[model samples]
Target: MKINYSPSKNAFYEEEHKERYLLSGSWPGDLIEVSRDDFIEYGGNPPEGKTRAPGPDNKPAWLTIPLDFVEQAKAENKRHTDEANNYINEQQWPSKLMLGRLSDDEKLLFNKWLDYLDALKEIDVSGAPDILWPTPPAEPAS
Candidate 1:
């Protein structure tokens, strides 16, 4: 993500100076190249670790995009939409809460998993695996 920082506006301050980021304008070397004009004129003029402040009118500009995350998020959203549509069409809408009453077998299965989900809500699962949850224990053979 790209962020633009400039001096405050329509507010009160103790002092006023040129915007810091406006002059620095250090873009990621991989992404942007400093213009020849900027290099010749503003190059190293500020000196080692020089600093400045922005005036009331100074406002910075920035442009950026999350190239990878955007694609991932888009894919995940499409998947969710497809899943929701499929569920609605095939299973039909259940009760507001986990559907209404179910057959004895269905009720037993739902309760068993519902308890597990509820238990999960009480714990942290940030690093949990995506599948084969509540992993089975290893077996010991003779």
Candidate 2:
């Protein structure tokens, strides 16, 4: 029986039994080594990988966003949006005063509130993993 050794797995495969065995010290036990092949045979590997292809060099990258931060941002976004809407609804504009006729202070306050709403709209809460916040670039070789 020809034995095929895989350095990456640190195991040996016997063509006779069509099985792979793990290397423990100097002894090869009867324990069958389970590989990706086994998972495929049993339909263990999920199809999710197909949809989300790996990053560069087939390696996967992950982003860690704090749960508390996400929740707080979402809450703040809702609060600001509601506050802006309420301000618009409660204001009683005079018949002679158009939007442009508003006082400087009123315009500034309204614009500030609208700016907050715009910022909140831009916050992405899809929870999708991203590499936008990458590690600092490595220094160039001297």
Leading candidate by lDDT: 2
TM-score of model number 1: 0.24
The CA lDDT of each predicted structure is 0.35, 0.44
lDDT, model 2, position 40: 38
Model 1, span 1-142: residue lDDT tens:
2233324421111112224423566322222223344334332323322222232334322213334444554454455445444543453324523556456654454444445444434432221211123321222243
Show model 1 residue runs off by greater than 4 Å: 1-60, 92-142
Stretches off by above 4 angstroms in model 2 are 1-76, 92-100, 127-142
lDDT, model 1: 0.35
Clashes of 1: 6
User: For candidate 2, what is the TM-score?
Assistant: 0.32
Q: Candidate 2: lDDT of 59?
A: 24
lDDT per residue (tens digit) for residues 80-105 in model 2 = 67766675556532321364577766
